[model samples]
Target: MATIGTHSGAFQADEALGVWLLRQLPQYESAPLIRSRDMEKLKPLTIVIDVAGTYDHDLLRYDHHQRGFFETFDGENKAAKDGGRPDVTGPETATGEFKTKLSASGLVYKHYGREVLIRLHPSLSANPDALDWVYRKMYEDFMEAIDGNDNGIELAEAVRYKESSTLPHRVHRLNARWNAPKDGPTEDERFETASALCGAEFGEMLRYIVECELPAREIVETALRARTAVHASGRARSKRYELERRHGLPAEGLVQFVLYPDSSGMWRVQAVTVEGTAFTNRLGLLEPWRGLRDAELVARSGIDGCKFVHATGFIGGNATYDGALAMALKTIEGGSTSVELK
Candidate 1:
């Protein structure tokens, strides 16, 4: 029988996830697993991961701890000002790149991810577009977090909530404690439990992306397509939906405003951000409506039912859906209104 090798003593989140991913593949489906640093033992195994000090697909040896290794999901830059360096892309670049460095889990995912997705969601095999989308989406939405956690990459360096609640932290906790008695669980036992944890989380993430996120893109797209008809300015009412989840930009890509009912049931008109750009709204709401609330907001905008427009003009609130649509429409028409809108 074939066997896989990883380092012994303690298992990590990346190796645990990598082992789980490997087990899903046919060649390794029933392969026996071994954890060891003994090169002699690892050398004869069918494959090794998170050990071996090498990353070569042909050899089936994957590890990211070695020096001179730096890779992101398609993009080489660790962090880009606009998700990419200026020279790497031009005006027509449509896709946003992931900035996290890869771990052994990422290495396994980078290779066998599509096959794994197809196996989990067999229906995806019939729809190549959806299959392709979910494949990339899974990496961005799920695997990147695993990779980031495994590599000690945090979203920001700012002082914020400091907590060890991430999956990697949870998996690390499963490792055998130093003060444990002889009756303690073996490393292999703990590793199996860690693998189960990683697998369950990965499955949950995949399900959410497939069932919830991908399908919701249609609502945003439909509203965007009806923009010209909704009004010459292209502002329409819909749920607080997301945009460009699948990167399927609507025709002309000129959607300016979205009118959605907030949690309070009050309507909010929001400016659309241009994809691949950072922090800039595609079209902001009317300047006069901003920074004023209730009666003052109505008086400033000459429109009734106005609640408030954000000081930045990126968003505004109204009492009714029709009022929200009017806010979106006025933003697209474009003119000075007491303030310079974003």
Candidate 2:
């Protein structure tokens, strides 16, 4: 029977998530979890996280609090070990250098994330590309924050105000409060609460990636491939009618705008919904032509065969495909009329 061990006090997101990730593996699914700080109590455990003072991948010991310990996703002490390798840095962080200060959760994820993802969603196991994409995307979207917060890495320079709503902060609050009743939940109980919270969030993220985001990627890929057919300018189109029926894809922030031919045979350049789950485009038509229509829009845009540019600039219709392409291109280029219209 395998066993996992961690510190016996209030658990942070790192350890909680680390333990949850371990449980996802078949070897550790039913393993007994012992929480303690004493070395003797942890001696028999197969894995130790967040409390052991040493980090040895082969030995399955993960801890980050030890002095002079610098391990990253690519391994340990990457900058010094690799002599400043150029590609060691990941695209997600853009830290400009290797040697990310990893937390216990990060160490576990770095080693077993892909395997865990495949276990959670077996369909992804067959598609190496999708599995790889989800593995990296999950780290970027979820795990990096835990690693960064645990390591005390300044996410960004204090521009104005600090961000208060982070996952690590929320998890930290789950611990039994200092001012709570004297007979409140025990440390072990609080640890279990944290584990459950982290595990629930982790499962929800996996479900979203597998159910929603993955299918959306397929649509985005298809749209990218058919961009040339939409217009010669090569701008991707999320055909509202098709996407709405097929996947109900959210277009606003996810997609800039969609170009489709209107019922009048004129091509329409419609702005996607930016405010809510509706049909309002965030980057509406240029300011100058906002309240203008038909000929007035054509005059300001310097494009012919113009049908109408809505007063709110949420949509515009042009008589020809070239005209709609010009509108979309000009809008994306920030109202620049200098684009060479074909």
Regions of candidate 2 where Cα sits further than 4 Å from its true position? 79-99, 236-285, 289-326, 332-342
Candidate 2 C-alpha lDDT tens digits along 1-342: 999999887778999999999999999999989999899998879999998797888999999887556776665664434566534443343333334578999989989999899888999989998898788778766887888888888766664576777667778998888799989988878887888888888989888988998788787668855655765544336633434435444442234457778666888887765432354454676768666778887898898877887766777888887888778778877832221111
The pairs that clash in candidate 2 are 273-280
Q: Which whole-number lDDT from 0 to 100 does residue 262 have in model 1?
A: 86
Model 1 worst lDDT window (10 residues) = 87-96
Give Cα-based local distance difference scores for all models. 0.75, 0.75
What is the C-alpha lDDT profile of model 1 across 231-252, one tens digit per residue?
Answer: 7634344322234334354543
Task: Give the true-structure RMSD of model 1.
Answer: 6.6
Clashes of each: 0, 1
Provide the RMSD of all predictions against the true structure, rounded to 1 decimal: 6.6, 8.3
- What TM-score would every model get versus the actual structure? 0.74, 0.72
Instruction: Compare the candidates by TM-score and give the number of the best one.
Output: 1
